[model samples]
Target: MPRAILDGTVLAESPNTVVIEGNHYFPDESVNHEHLTGTATETVCYWKGTARYYSAVVSETVFRDIAWYYPDPSQEAASIKNYVAFGRPVQVEL
Candidate 1:
């Protein structure tokens, strides 16, 4: 199983994850919404389409824009649509 963690807390965990470019994309249902705060930040990936970010807020700490997902992905990355991927302060453990 793969899990997304922040500040020792599991933000998301799933066995059915998609690995793209070595990043584990966890299913939406596996994520803990309480720890995620939607952000205005957005980035475009040539093959993945536009990605929207989320800040991981745990206790008194905030990991800004550490997680992202494509709400509507390009055809090439349709399988990862709505799946979340972590980076930086958010740790992905396999």
Candidate 2:
């Protein structure tokens, strides 16, 4: 199993994460919703489709758009649709 931790909190823990390149994609429900503040930031991945982002807020400190997910992933990466993935500085433990 692998877990994504940030700001000393475990955001996600799962065994069914999809690894694309080196990033672990945890199902949306696996993430800690309380720590997320939805944002308008988005990026497009040529093969993975459009990605939506969420800022990670810890106490009074805010990490802008530190997590992302593909709401509508392409066919080649459909397995990770709506899966959340963390960015650097967020610890990923296996």
Candidate 3:
């Protein structure tokens, strides 16, 4: 499995991290929500529907819009509807 880490903390870990529209979508259970702070930021994906974001704050290091999820994803992308993903310098390793 590969894990996404930020500020020395694990953000997400999964065996199947899908990249859609450039964002890496990890399984919902793979994310560590304790360090994630929901934000008002959102963007529409033509096929994925509207995606919401979370600012991952760890050890005083805040990565803006580091994580996202499609609350109401399109049927085609439904598998990752509630799943979260990372971006903007989020590091991933096995």
Candidate 4:
């Protein structure tokens, strides 16, 4: 199983993941909502469509734009819709 963690707090974990561009995208249901909050941040991928972000707060420390998912992905990247991916400060334990 693979898990997304921040300061030892598990954010998301799943045996099934979609790998794109070397990033592991976990299913929406696998995420631990208590550690994340949606933000206004969004970025567009030329082929994957728009990505919405979430911030993680662990022990009162805020890590912004640490997780992202495409709520509505393009046809080419539809498999990843609703799948979350962690970046940078967030660690993915395999």
Top candidate (lDDT): 4
- lDDT score for residue 82 of model 2: 93
> What's the lDDT for candidate 1?
0.92
Compose the digit string of candidate 3's lDDT tens values, residues 1-94.
8889886788888898887776678888879899999999999988879989999888887888888899889999988878898886788776
lDDT of 2: 0.90
**Which window of 10 residues has the lowest lDDT sum in candidate 4?**
2-11
Clashes (backbone N, CA, C under 3 Å), per candidate, total 0, 0, 0, 0
lDDT against the true structure, per candidate, is 0.92, 0.90, 0.85, 0.94
Give per-residue CA lDDT, model 1, range 33-84, as digits (tens).
Answer: 8989999999999989999999988988888998999999999999999999
Minimal lDDT window, size 10, model 2? 54-63
Clashing pairs in 4: none
Best by TM-score: 4
- Residue 21, candidate 2: C-alpha displacement in angstroms: 1.3
List TM-scores for all candidates, in order.
0.95, 0.95, 0.87, 0.97
Write down the TM-score for model 3.
0.87
How high is the lDDT of residue 85 in model 1? 93
Clashing pairs in 3: none
